[model samples]
Target chain A: MAENQGVLVYLEHREGKLLPIALEGLGAGRRLADTLGQRLSCVAIGSNIAQLASQAIAAGADRVYLMDSPELADYQPDIYLALMGQLVAEARPQVIIMGHTDTGREIAPRLAFRFGTVAVTDCVELNIDNTSGRLLATKPVYGGNALAVFSTDTDPQVVTVRTKAMAPAVPNASRQGEVITPAYKVEPSVVRARIVRRVLAESAGVKLEDAAVVVAGGRGIGGAEGFKQLEDLARLLKGAIGASRPPCDSGWISDTAQVGLTGKIIAPELYIAVAISGSSQHMSGCSGARTIVAINKDREANIFRHARFGVVGDWKKVLPAFTAKVKELLAS
Target chain B: MNIIVCVKQVIDPEAPPSSFRIDPATNRAEMRGANPVIDPYGEYAVEAALRLKDAGGAKVTVISLGSNLLREVVKKPLAMGADELILLEDAAYDGGDSYSTALALAAAIKKIGQYDLILCGREASDTNAGQVGAGVAEILSLPCVTLAKRLEAGAGNLVVERVTSAGYDVVEVGLPAVITISNEIGEPRYPTVKGIMAAKKKEPLVWKPTDLGLDASRLGSAGRKVKLLRLYQPVYEGRCEFVEGQTPEEAGANLAIKLREAKVI
Candidate 1:
């Protein structure tokens, strides 16, 4: 079992397409593997992912393991866990990596616990300590107010990297790797939870998570109507509209648009925060953004402190004018 | 039916960023004038439990493991509709990471011995580590699900709507299972004046680690399986210039030009 020891990355895909975070995980795994002088391997579980296995090799894995089954067409925690547990028992990899998505966060710890270990979730940075030769995981704690570095004495360090933290691996079309189709079985009767339905939230235009430039509204926007201005601004900027917890809680926007500690963490190149007083919780999600511009009527608003540029005025007056300016600039 | 909800008291998530500082010496946060509150997601869990109670007859017992100061925050769930509160207040439980915290919580729940269901927040705001729910379930040998947006009771089972990456999944799990509720469950209800008055009469029973038939030595940092090596703040280093303009339109135009010049657009 120790013969396959190396770094194993969990590759997540949907609709036969590899996820962005999966590539990111591979990139991270490659770096860690190179540093540890071990080979980088990737594991994907689904009904049809052999094409994805080839993509993993191009994306930097030296080896790819595919667990194909009809039952895995959609994500069922029970089936997926059973498959992964069998793989880990047989492969005995030194390190395991996954993206800190909903699935990863839900499964990593339980998987680690089954092996009598613990997982470090939502890690922003990972490195091997030169002295101890241990994986050092750095993650945000206290709602992104502080960073804590963690190390475990246990073998097979399990970690879930946060989204947008690591650069995705560049595809090398000529790269080659081994594809092992591991034989695993999942019993349906053991799975107590069964998916009766899946309701997808309707997404309008650009998803907030993928938008490069985001125009976000807050409670100061007043109500749902105020978000229309932001929507107009977002359209003009060719970006997406985001919201603080207050606006989302107020029903002005869907919870999906919430950018905060409890919401989605985004790392767009530019962020335009409007009328949002920055609390630590809200700022945590946007802290990774490269540039921030804040517009708030209150001069003392906490958002201004984090913004790279600030405008103090009534947003009712500012938003429309700002939208017009953006329109003019784009048109010209 | 009876249920147990695990609540944690953490520094207010709404506190301004500048109010937090880390002591590198001890690898911990230095709270400055920031009041502690029940974890926001935990409130949602309590709300989920209370909704179930409203629908049927159920007794909800809220449990927390932290400093004695947590008494102020744990009472919140009681005011919101929990029947009783139990605080595992002792110095032995201080600075315990999620694994140890779950161990202590699981021990407490086993002692309670009447819960048909167990619920907790998706994660505590302060630690931001979401291992406790699964860890508790692992220790208790119960089925578990995370990030549940909605839950309803069924015949000998529970129906849960869990939020997945692409959508929500409708799931059914057997009774005596653990569920970690997400904020999508909806806003927690505020305590009415009468509920607040009722809470005053329901004093939380304090328990030590030994009271739950657990070893005090295996309760806090000593019991933690993971080691925190360091703690520090990420430097903001962002320098923002105030945009000058006579009218809001003028500032907007200037800001746009500045962004264009910086090649950020």
Candidate 2:
């Protein structure tokens, strides 16, 4: 049997802020490690992420591995992959967990390939096999119409967990853990990918994932003008405007506002699907919303099945009236 | 320049929920009646390649691994102006997972020999596993960049806009790299009648594992590292309560009132 090793969570950060998914990864890592009676270690790789290392420990990590270097900033794939691969070699975590974000999706599979292991991405649930001690990851397949529970016989099972699926590790403030700063050598010449610039897409109101209410438009919304109404509704609800794949593919909405299997998986308190006939692909992301309200001209739209409230009519006429009512209710 | 884009045929992802049927015997999701389409993201990859070809002279060959049933779907990139299409089809290749798929593609890419770049979609819609592109890169020992929203094939290297959490990163990488194109690449261009006619003339060449010299043990389901125990749809408990009213405004107002009553507002 391959040696039972510790669980490692890859910590992701951007603009000096530890991304929310990192804490979620640690939370997931903590659970697996606890179940297996193994230690949980968080690997923080970035420029000046020492504070993040300590926070990781406070947030439930048993050990924190810090690899701080100027070259680590801005996320050059080559450098990050190299450092992470090397860390995995040295640390030898039996189960590796990462968020199924852009970075995690890129790194987990590649790293698993390098190790001759298997990688399962965007897992909504995970468990340990009692007999083999393998990591069993539950992932959605067939566009979320079904879930496949998979397990890898290869050692050091690597998995990427979807956002909002797991609770994040809350800081205890007094918790302590070992901090290991490994001596790693990454020559700049070996790094092939270089980031020359970065620009954030402009967004207004609440961030989609964090919003209490999400007013998402789909292809039925027609064009950018349809999104304008959604934007107005979102603003009235103190929420954010999101989209299904069509609107984003049509360039009517920014990709950041996209919510689906390939896009951001969100679970707002209330999901207002406007003019969107729900496909399994789009509904996969928003199935977690507490209450879904679908407004579409198509009376037979699949979204009505899952929504808490279904308004069967033209969203163009329905939205304005809906927004006015919401406004009146808010004022009252 | 020779560019290869790995494409796959998948069951339509946009199919309605009622169309999904669980085959209790097989424990897999099956559609009652379905039309297969080129994975949407793969269209973006084709678009990315065509854009590169438009800027400079290049031959784009799209390679897809699936059943012979995908012959029509495989011709999509060809209609989008790709120079050639290679379909890796065989009974042995049936029900292969992503790892097997990548291994087969890597073998095909090696057989093609000379290539400046390889492109793929960020993930396949059916499996939703964004691993095959990176996995192929691993087998070939080549540098890979995933989720490229914008790409420019410069001399000796490529510049790209990589999507990140906060925004996009402009990345520079050498040639002979693998790039997984994202939805941010914009809508794939529809084929003109002329292009469709040209595509019909360019027949796809089908190849089996034996052609690539891949053995039975190292290909298909046998090569898979992960074992699937079961497949089932998640049960969503709630059903929508239809709002009926004399007017749209009344219905909308009642929805608000219901939300207020439920204390969700």
What tens-digit string does per-residue lDDT give for candidate 1 at B78-128?
Answer: 888889999989999998877789889999999999888999999988888
**Per-candidate interface C-alpha RMSD?**
1.7, 1.4
Point out where model 2 deviates above 4 Å.
A1-4, A14-17
What does candidate 2 score on TM?
Answer: 0.96
lDDT of 2 by residue, A1-332 (tens): 35749899999886666688998888888888989999999888888877886778888998988988876776777777888898888888899999998788888999999888669999999888889778889999888888999998876789999998988888787988999999888878766677888788887778888999999999898999889888888898899989998898788878888898878899999999988888888988898898898888777788887888878887777778888888888898
Lowest-sum lDDT 10-residue window in model 2 chain A: A70-79
lDDT of 2: 0.85
The complex in candidate 1 yields a DockQ of 0.68
Worst 10 residues of 1 chain A by lDDT: A187-196
- How far does residue A304 in candidate 2 sit from its true spot (Å)? 1.7
